[model samples]
Target: MILNGITVGIILILIGLYGMIAKKHVFKIIFGLIIISTGLVLFFVSVGYVDTGAAPIVSGDTTYVDPLPHTLMLTTIVVEVCTTTLALVLALKIYEKYKTLDISTLEDL
Candidate 1:
């Protein structure tokens, strides 16, 4: 059920969006960003699907899955990980600044 995967990705993306929009906590925003990145990665990886595709290696049999998108997805994931780390660092900075991770609390600072 490929459609099921799509639906799940969509749900995750929506939940992430809601968290990003509704939550006032800096930590939750970072997690929401991770969720959204995961959804996007899932969607991009799905595009390289083939019902009877083989691995990216040069096997004796042909019909290999496209390697381009998968490689790009890998790069994207690396960037996401770096972004997550940076977000965590920013959250830490926020905590140090206001003594609380809540965005609303930072308004007084």
Candidate 2:
């Protein structure tokens, strides 16, 4: 019954999925996507966590956290930012065309 970053990330991902599926607002859906990405970042970072770990550059025998997950998460964050920006622009265009953020309303047209 331990609450860790991975657990929190999984919870966030689930919540985001629910929000995206259940909500009708385009902005809400976009926010859900952002939440999911954040969860993924958290999950990856937690996966690389090590207690009393030193920096990757070391000579002696010492525990070090894997740098790969952190590096990948950084790339993920950049991609997420780009994706979010594009999605927001598309949502803005949709609103401009339809004057509504509701997906159900947009679907009717």
Best candidate according to TM-score: 2
Name model 2 segments beyond 4 Å from true. 55-61
User: How many residue pairs in model 2 have overlapping backbones?
Assistant: 0
Question: For model 2, what is the error of residue 37's alpha carbon versus the real structure, in angstroms, after optimal superposition?
Answer: 0.5
**Each model's TM-score, in the order given?**
0.86, 0.90
TM-score of 1: 0.86
Report how far residue 80 has shifted in candidate 1, in Å: 1.1
lDDT on C-alpha atoms for all candidate structures: 0.83, 0.91
75 Cα displacement, candidate 1 (Å): 1.1
Q: Best-fitting candidate, measured by lDDT?
A: 2
* Position 56, candidate 2: lDDT: 71
- Residue 67 shift from truth in candidate 2, angstroms: 0.8
105: Cα error in model 2, Å: 1.0
lDDT of 1 by residue, 67-87 (tens): 887899889899989999999
